[model samples]
Target: LAVEPDIWFLDEPFSALDPLIRREMQDEFLRLQDILKKTIVFITHDFDEAIRLADRIAIMKDGAVIQIGTPEDLIINPATEYVAEFTRDVSRAKVFSARMVMRPLAPDEKGSLGELLKHDVKVQEFADQAVNSEDRIGVTDDAGSIIGVIDRQSVLNVLVGRESAGSY
Candidate 1:
């Protein structure tokens, strides 16, 4: 019998397996989702796993769902101490995008910079590459057009906690 369901309700389905095998299964499952396009209720105690696999995570504590959000949302704006504690070790630069910290460009600066990056590019991906530059890194939209620029100071403010990513 061919068995296929529209939804996948998985409850620590990989918990019992060896770590290596579990990782493989997680990769395969994510690939399967891309093909089958099914809604998955993936329950995992591993926070990293949840971050990697789930588009939206529902964190439950004491049998109650405490907060539900995208990984970036939960990490940047933790609803409670418990949520913060869980995401405390996560790397903010890896999770936050240029759009999260970029400022709208002034008219005089449009398309002026010789180098540009996408607005949706993750901050860490390009932050280091532009550190030696004298000016802010220009950010572009999908149409290869400048939309905003991420100043070095702004990126530093976010990384050093002088400014909150959620505030932008």
Candidate 2:
């Protein structure tokens, strides 16, 4: 980072560190990346780390790339059984955002929208609030304009794996 290269190729950079230190390093790495905005090719066997660090991930098998996409893509639509198995245990609520599950405002629907959630907020962050509420919660974009709404059924569908992020 001192030299400020345009791209970084890191292989298992924090694999040997203890869990706590590895997390700290990951945080520091994210901070640097935010400031540097450099393209990074991070190689790690840790799935959680890959999800945390990568904007797009390429899953390889036997030296061949099997699938490449954003974390949400892989989670919502696994390319193969291998890919599905790889993400089977992952929590959808953690990967999916409110925008992914929200329904567009209906033409005749006009009333109080209740509490609003940002488009990029993960389902896990507001699962309880959404599930317990009788009315749909509004979702907003960067400009704070209401773009869509999320309901209890939508949140439940994600938690139960009955719906895909792309379905919306």
Candidate 3:
């Protein structure tokens, strides 16, 4: 990182460390990436680590690339059975966003919508709030304009893995 290269290829950079140290290194890595904004190709057999650090992941098997996509994309629509099994244990709410679970706002229900959440905010971030609210929570875009709504059922669906990212 001292030379400021345009890209970095890290293969199990923290694999040798203890659990606590590995987590700290991962945090530090994220902090450095935020400041440097360098493109990174991080290779790891740890799926959880991949989900935490990668914007896009390519799943490979026996030297063949199986699928490539964002964490959300891979979680929601895995390309093959292997991909599905690979991500089956992941928490859906952690990977899905408000935009991915929200329903389109009806014209008559616009005025009744509850608190607004950003489109990219993950379902896990607001699950408790949404579940406790009686009214449907509104989902907003970058401009803060309401584009959709998420009800208690929607939040529950995500928590229970009954909601599909493509359903919204």
Model 2 TM-score, all chains together = 0.90
What would the per-residue lDDT of candidate 2 be over residues 32-63, giving only the tens digit for each residue? 99988999999999888998889999999999
- Greater TM-score among 1 and 3 belongs to 3
Which whole-number lDDT from 0 to 100 does residue 107 have in model 3? 92
* C-alpha TM-score for every candidate: 0.77, 0.90, 0.89
| 81 Cα displacement, candidate 1 (Å) | 2.3
> What overall lDDT, based on C-alpha atoms, would model 2 receive against the true structure?
0.89
Tens digits of per-residue lDDT for model 1 on 48-161? 788778889998889999999988889877899999898887777767788788788899987566568887787778777666677778888899888888877877776765
Q: For residues 1-168, write the lDDT of model 3, one tens digit per residue.
A: 689899999999999999999999999999999999999999999888888888899999899999999988888888999999999989887778898888898899889987999999988899999888797899999999999999999889888878665576
Mark the 10 consecutive residues where model 1 has the least summed lDDT: 158-167
Which residue pairs show collisions in model 3? none
Q: Which residue runs does candidate 2 get wrong by more than 4 Å?
A: 107-110
Judged by lDDT against the true structure, how good is candidate 1? 0.81
